[model samples]
Target: MTLEGKHALVTGGGTGIGLAIARDLAAKGAQVTITGRRQEVLDTVAAESAGLFGLAMDVRDEADVIDKVAAAVAERGPVQVCIANAGIAEGRAVHKMDLAFWRNMMATNLDGAFLTIRESLKSMRETDWGRVIAVASVAGLRGLPGAACYTASKHGMVGLIRALSEDYLGRPITFNALCPAYVDTEIVDRNTASISQRAGVSADEAREIMVSANRHRRLIRPEEVAAAAAWLVSPGSESVNGQAIEIAGGMM
Candidate 1:
């Protein structure tokens, strides 16, 4: 049950779901390296939590991801648990979406996950056991209206994990994605404003729309997603490979 010797890496670990997962892993005795674009934000969080080290790195930049992950490995040993949680979510109708918006969405949500996992695997492959978990969205499983690019990017993440699972079938490492419905994070807050402006609704009504989208009629908590990530690395989940575990209130 203890990850005393394990080293975990979480991208976008400065806030929201990533921070929750990072703190949870650290509490479980893993030395967690938390990466984000802002050094000050990461440093503040690291200072408040034991076993959590802050590293400033941008997932969208290949060289930054490579060198930063290498630096973390140099300091804390190989990353035994890698979480690709850095992403961006924006909703725009297909007809209204420009190439710039679509590309930026893919770059952060899809390309970022690819780079994070590819770099982490370099060290994780040398270890006896490892875990790679991506914080994808429920949109990964089903098409979502008004967010075509976001949905497509998440679908790519789920496919990546599934394919990697097949490639490493007999290995001790497990690849998986945590698909959660509208979690109560900063992203949701931003989305609420965006939705309100677009739909000509009150901010509260916009937020309520998301809360009602969940089958259980409530936004999810970041800690709920973190719990799923924690369980994936636990000794009991050895056979849970390539699964897109949903934290949604109910099946989509």
Candidate 2:
């Protein structure tokens, strides 16, 4: 159960689910590189864990992903586990959405995941084994109300992972996605405020709206997703490809 010599990269690893996964990989003896747009946040978190290195990189920018990831490989080794986890989530009705809003959602969620996976694969494919995991949303499997743009972007992310899985079916590399609902992260905390402002409700009331979406009627912890990620990259997960594993406490 040791990834003693593996090199891993997690995009948007400064906080939330990405950070949890990065820490877990580091704990398992992988030289993990955590990337995000915020340097301070990355530095702060990386210091708390062994084998975790923070590099400030934006997933939405192609040049940044290519150069930074290449540098990470040179400093450590080829990336054997690539987690395309950087993304943004927001809710807005279709009729009221502007072009910037729509494009912003797609650019960060779908385009960012694509760029991260493609760049990481440059080094990952050089190795005999690899894992590519996309942190998609439960919304990807079903239409989310008042979030058409977000739903579309996640669907694209899931589609990309599925297609890549089929293309690399016989290879040692595997592609999969984790679709979680109502994670108890900063994103949900912020969304509560946004929902309150938009819908004229109390922040607590708005938060409950998201919490109730989960079948368990509670927000999920970040470590739960990290556990799944650790399993996917472990030695025996070669057959677990092209799956969008839902973590919503029940079937969707």
Q: Number of the top candidate by TM-score?
A: 1
In order of appearance, the predictions have TM-scores of 0.99, 0.98
- Tens-digit lDDT track of model 2 for 1-252: 888999999998999999999999998999999999999999999889779899999887889888999999999999899999999989998999999999888888999999988988888888899999999999999999999999999999999999999999898999999999989999998899999999999999999999888999999999999999999998788899999999999987
- Candidate 2 regions exceeding 4 Å error are none
Poorly placed runs, candidate 1 (over 4 Å): none
Q: Model 2, residue 185: what's the lDDT?
A: 93
Q: Residues 44-95, candidate 1, lDDT per residue (tens digit)?
A: 9999778999999988899999999999999999999999999999999999
What C-alpha lDDT, on a 0 to 100 scale, does residue 143 get in candidate 2? Answer: 96
lDDT of each: 0.95, 0.93
TM-score of 1: 0.99
